[model samples]
Target chain A: MQFWIVQSLNSLALGGLLFLLATGFSLIFGLMRIANLTHGALFMLGAYVGVTTLKFVPNLWLAALIAGLLVALFGGLLERSILRRLAGNALGQVLVTLGVSFIVADFCLIVWGGDPIPIAAPTSLQRPIVVGNIAFPAYRLVVLGIAIITAIALHLLMERTRLGAMIRAGVDDMQMARAVGVPVSRLFTTVFCLGAALAGAGGVIAGPIMSAYPGLDADMLPLALIVVILGGVGSLLGAFVGSFVIAIIYTFGSALLPDLAYVILFLPMIVVIAFRPRGLFGRRST
Target chain B: MSAAARIVLVLVLVAFPLIGGDFYINLASQIFIAALFATSLNLLVGYGGLVSLGHAAWIGLAAYTSAWLYLHLGLRHWITAPLALVNTTLIAGLFGWIALRATGLGFLMITLALSQVLWGTAYRWAAVTNGDNGLSGLTRPAPFGISLDGPAAFYYFSLTVTIVAVWMMARLVNSPFGAALRGSRDESRRMSALGHNVWLVRWLTFVYSGFWGAVAGLLFVYYHKYIHPTALSLTSSAEVLLGVIAGGAGTIAGPIVGAAIVLILKNYVSAYLDRWNMLLGAVFVVIVIFMPDGIVPGIRRWSARLRKT
Candidate 1:
């Protein structure tokens, strides 16, 4: 019973990080109708920033905040300059972002070096609490708590706010939203930065567990893609549900299959997609 | 553009091995193989209007099959070549059936997930695949009782195969089936209304591209004499994708030109600086932003302008 509970917590911890990343990815995909491949690189960039910040200030929260802010700014610039110009050209957007990601990844490699650098949790959260027979790390619990709070916060922001309404409207129909006096150009920049910030925040928060690595972009991209697809593109609830499903599968699949874990990981998505081509929560495209 | 000009181009390419030294011959052989791979990818992106990000999976599958056959079963090149095509076509059929259910982004993600499945298998199945360290020491086979041990002989062999394949692809693109595929890409609803089976066209294109991709893989393994999981990686897929976009999509020869430019840059630039990916990324950005039609169409436009002037 204790082992299963601890494993479930592990799954939640992984799911939490995935939730943060995929929510942003889905939002961007919903609005732009383009796959922002550079979002993965932003996640990597966030982790690197966290690593650098930790060297100066020993606080995890501060380091994560700094990392998130830095990447958000970068994301804003990318949106304003590059993405805005490309507009409706999906292929062009993909290639441009891909190119940006390559440069960013290489720069990270040059600065941080190739070795995986672990970002240590704060001294306060480093300790483990006894749960039944198992000792679960306090930081992992903290991560789970943060994820729940963020999910709720995102839900409220999207549900109650005028900005959220505009975003939703834009996702439904960009030209319609624009014609109705919604400043979609500015909105695009805001949403993109917001999404980037979330991914960066997820990176910093999960950095201690996964560690900052060179190829983290490549590693996390498929997971994020799986989550967004399973949950439904642009739906926060879908992203949340998808994250848990994938996290549980990953946690258990790694334990069960070990070597064939990725294959196991892919199977559920394939099955899900075969049945629901638009994804579990995806809105059908006209 | 004339038949005479086309014949001359082919003759020059066929005779390249005679004038070029061993190094040039090897480099040209790699270019030809890359061209074949990119051309196959173009069959989807250019002709079928599907941008599959995981096309390298088929190529990698065939290469690994050839390597495994050579290592474990001692199967000769002649036997393995046909087997690789069958392997690729079967997998393509299965994956395409599932993936083609969704269009656009969903399709791209499904293809990516499928490739990762193969990548995981290659990484995990250590006893058979030799895992990440990769399988090496597969020698060049004597196809039709002719030894391709030397660089020149192998180059000629590769050239013959690539030319034949490209010609077949040209024929395919001009056929009635190809017209339907193109029509579907431009206006699927209209095509369907006109009695064309859009889904079947896309499926057949996917399978056809997979077959040619497998052929490219056979050439790749034969030339390099090794196979690794990296061939199945997202990076390899992206490289072929970049070639298709940079060369200009919706054109038959565009991807081949795109592949040549990219491979040349990779080979020549890496020799100078270790940050070739950075340079390549910047180049890609420039191309996408300014020359969205890619190098081939961009050149064509410029030449057309010069003639008018």
Candidate 2:
């Protein structure tokens, strides 16, 4: 029973990290209709940037903020410059993002070399907390707390703010949103920035667990894709539930059935997609 | 292409090895295999309008099956090769039925996810696959009593297989089924309305492409005598797709040219440069920006306009 509790906590930690990476990916896909393959690369770039920031300012939270801002600026440029040029060519746009990702991945390798860089967790969260005859890793609990806070914050922004309302309109119908003077072109840039910032911040948070590595982008990209596919695009509830479910499946699968882990992982995905091509909670395409 | 041009191209291919020595012979062999592989992918991307990112699954599956059988069970290449091709094709049919459930971006994601699953399986299933250390040292077969142990001899053998494969594919694309496949690519609703069974068309195309991909895998292992998880990796699938698109997805000869350009950049240029991936990425971006339809079609359009002017 205790072992199961420990595993469940680990799964929750991973699911929280996934939410940060995938929420942005889902939003970008929902609004722009582009899969935004470069989001994974952005996540990896954020970790490296956060590591560099830690050198100047030892505060992990500050480093994460700086990393998020820088990554957002870069992502905005990418949207305005390259992806904007391939308007209406969906496949071409996807390919361009792929090209940029390849470039980013190679540059990361060139700059950081191939080894994984492990970032130390904050000192306060290093100890394990005991509760009800079981010990829980404090870092994991903090991660869950952070995820819940971000979730609540995002909910408030979407439900209570005018900017969130406009973004929601755009997700529902870009043409109608434009007709109502929503400034969609600028909105595109803004949403792209927000999504990139989330991924970058998530990257810094994941550093203590995953580390910055050469193939991290490749490793994370598929998981995010699965999350988006399993969860409906632009649905926060869907992303939340989907992330936890997938995280639990992956964590327990590796522990229990190490050899057939992936086979088990992808089989349900294929079955679900065969039945529900639009995802369980996904809305009709605009 | 004109008849005279085709004849001259074949003649040059036949004569070049005589003058180029072992290094060029080996390089040329690699290109032929890649060209064949890229062409197989084009059957889906070009004719059927499906961009399958897991196409390497077939190639890797066939190669590993054949190599592992010979290594562990003492099976001969002659037997394992055909068995490998059949097994891969059957599996492709099943995967295609599942993947074709979604069209456009959904199809692309499903294919990518499925391939990732296979890649994970290959990396983690240590006892059977040896877990990424890879299986190596397979014996090359002698066909028609001719030894293929020599690089130049194998080059000629590969050239024959590539020619035959391309010829068959050309016939396939010109057939009634090819027309139906193309119809579905441009208009699925209309084809369904016309009683075409678009699903069957795509499923068959996927299986046919997988069979040809397995053929290329046999040649790949014959040439390299090695197999690894990287053989069926997402990167490998992406590289083949890149070659197909860059050459001209729908054109027959376009993939050949595109595959050559990509392989040379990957093999020849990488030898001299430390950052070939960045160079390749830049090439992808440039091609998308300047020549969206790819080299052959782009040149054809320009020349047509030139003639009109």
Candidate 3:
């Protein structure tokens, strides 16, 4: 029972991180209709940036904030300079983004020298919190807490704010939104930057637990993609739900059948897609 | 080029290997094998209008299967190679049946996911795949009184396979079934509404693509004499896609041209620059932006205009 509790908590922590990474992916896909294969590279950049900042600043929080902001700026530039030109061309967009991703990944390797860099967890949350016979890492709990808070904050922002309303409208019908003078081109840039910021934030937070490495970008990209697909593309709530479900399945699966964990993770996706091609929470195309 | 001109070009290609020393012959052989890989990809992307990002999985699958058969079963190349091809085709058929249900971006994502599944399986299944160390020491067969152990002999064997494969593919593309497949690519919904099974066509195309990929995989194993997990990786799939884009997706010779450019560029760049990926990335971006129809199509268009004038 204790092992199960710890495993379950670990799963939630991991799920929270996945949700953060995937939400941005979902949002970008929804609004821009551009599959940013470079999104994972941006996430890796964030961790790299955050870890580097910590060397001088010695403040984890400030480093993470700076990293997220920098990534957002970089994303905005990418949108204006490259992605904007490839609009409405799916194959072109995929190739371009994938190219950018490869460049970024290789650049990271060149700079970082393929070593895993450790990020320092906050001193207050360094130790495990023990309750009777059960023990859990406090930092993980904090990460989960922050994830929930961010989710709520995002929900409120999207549900209550005018910007959120515009985004929702744009997602529903880009043509209609453009007709109503929604400034879609600028909106796309903003959404892309915002999604980058979210992925960056996830990267910074996950750095402490997962460690920052040259090959980490490749490892995370597939998981983020799987989450986006399993949760239904372009749905934040679905991302959250799908992240937790996938995390649980992955964690438990690795424990139960180590060799088959990947196969098991993919099995659900295949089954879901076969039955509901759009996804679990995906909206049907009209 | 005209038909006669094209035949002369092929003859030159074949003859160049005989005259151009070992280095060039090896390079040319690599190009031919990679061309086969890219052509297989075009079968789906160009003809079927399906973009599969994980097509390399089938290639890797065939390579590993053949490697395993040769290592464990002690089977010679002639018998083991056909068995490997059949295994790969069956697996491809099964996976294709499920994958054909999705269209557009959905199909691309599913293929990517499936490839990851295969990669993970290969990486973790240490006993069978030998984990990251990979399987080595695979030798060519001495069947029918012909030894294929030498590099020169292997090159000729691979070249023969490429010629035969391309010819078969050309015939298939010109056939009624090929016409139907192209029709579905243009108007899938209409074809389905007209009582044609769009899913079946797509599935068949996927399987065909996989089979060709497997054949290329076999040739690759023969050429390199080794099989590794990277063969089934997403990067390999991306490289094949890059080849399709670089050469011209829709044209028969496009993938060949694309593979030649990509492999040669990759070889040359990686030899000097440590950051070859950045260069490759820049190349892909340039090609996608400036030459969306690919080098072959652009050249063809230019030549056609010149002739018309």
Candidate 4:
């Protein structure tokens, strides 16, 4: 019972982090047809930046905020300088992102060395909270809370804001959006930055649980890829559901059938890809 | 581009290990293996326009199968080699069936995800794969009573296989099927309307590519006498893709030159520099921005324009 409870909570927490990563990835893939392979490296970069900021600030939220902003700024620069140059060349842009990912990964390794950096939660959230028969890590619960809050905030921002409407219009139809004067090009940078910020902040939040490691980008990128692939690009709901599904499979599959975990996880994905192609919630038209 | 140049190039590569020093014969063998692998990928990416990111898994899969069979089951190379090739090709069929369901980005992602599945299996399944330590100390094959135990012998072996493989690819490229493949890549619906059977064409190409990729994997194992999870890594796939792009995806000469450049830069430069990966990344960025058509084709265009001027 205790094992199940822990695993379940762990899955939920991981799902929350994945949501932060995948939502941005899905949006970037939708708005711009390039797969931002650098997003994974960005997550790693954010974790490193968060680790550095934590040394000075001592506040988890402040560190996360600073990490998010800096990473966002980095992403914006990438878009303006490189991605923008290869506008319609999807493959070219994707390759450039791959280059950037490599550069950033090496940069992180050089700066932080090869050791994994353990980040601590704020003092208030350091201790576990007790329930009837089981004690839950307060930090884990806090991560879940942050995920929910982020989701709500994102939902509200998307639904209630003019920028949200414009983004939606652009996502639906780029040419049509431009015809109506939606400033789609600037919006592209904005969306890219937003995605970068979310992934960056999520990295800080995940630091306590996963730690800042050398190959964190490689470890996390596949999860984000699976989420975006399974969830359908540009669909927040798909990312939400896909995150939990993949997280549950990843966590429990590792715990129970450690050897056959990938078989269990990848088998369903193969089946879905074979049959559905568009993913569970993918839009009808390309 | 002329027959005389092609013959000269072939003669030079064929005789490289002889005059290039005994130390570099091994390097030449490695380069040939990579070039062949790049060519196989070009069959799909360059000709079929099916850019797959997970095809590296096929290389790892075949290598693992052969290694495992030899190590645990005490099987010989002649038996294990064919078994590994067949196994990898069959699996590629299944993976291809799934991956080819979507076009463009979806297809690319599915291929990547599925490869991750294999890489994860190799990484986590310690009992079979030995995990991070990897499976090592394998012996090379001796075909027709000729032992491939020395650098010169292995170089000839790699050279022979690569020559035959490239010839096979060239024949396939000039066939009517090749024309159909290009048509489908350029306009899928239109090709289908013209009764090209686009999916089947792609499926066949994927399996064929897998076969050659497995061949590359076979040489990889014999060359290093080892197999590891890193063989199936995304970096491996990216490297092959970059080689294809940098050389000239559609041209026969492109991948050959590209692979040679990539292997030399990676092997020789990494020996001197710790930041080789960053340089590699920079190469990727620079190549994409400036030489997107690849070196061979870009050079051809430049020479053409220069002549016109």
Question: Against the unseen true structure, what C-alpha lDDT does each candidate score?
Answer: 0.87, 0.86, 0.85, 0.89
lDDT of 1 at B263: 91
Across A1-286, the per-residue lDDT of candidate 4 in tens digits comes to 9999989999999999999988899889877887899989999999999999998999999999999999999999999999999999888888899889999999999999999999998889888888888888889888988988888888887789999888878778889999999998899999999999999999999999999998899888888988877878787777888888999999999999998788788866766665666667767422
lDDT of 3 by residue, B1-309 (tens): 589998998788768756888877888888889999999889899999998988988889999999999898888777888999999999898778666767777677778778878888788777778989999988766657788776577778888889899888878888888888898999988988988888888888898889999999988988888989888877788888999988999789899999999999888988887776788788889999999999999999999999999
Error of 1 at B154 (Å): 0.9
TM-score of 1: 0.97
lDDT of 4 at B17: 69
What candidate 3 gets wrong by more than 4 Å, as runs, is: none
Best by TM-score: 4
iRMSD for every model? 2.1, 1.9, 2.2, 1.7
Position B27, candidate 3: lDDT: 83
- CA error at residue B85 for candidate 2, angstroms: 1.2
**In candidate 1, how many Å is residue A36 off?**
0.6
Lowest lDDT block of 10, candidate 3 chain B: B97-106
Q: Who is ahead in TM-score, 1 or 4?
A: 4
- Measured against the true structure, the TM-scores of the candidates, in listed sequence, are 0.97, 0.96, 0.96, 0.98
lDDT of candidate 2 over B38-78, digit per residue (tens):
99999999999988888999888898888888898998778
Question: TM-score for model 4?
Answer: 0.98
| lDDT ranking of the models | 4, 1, 2, 3
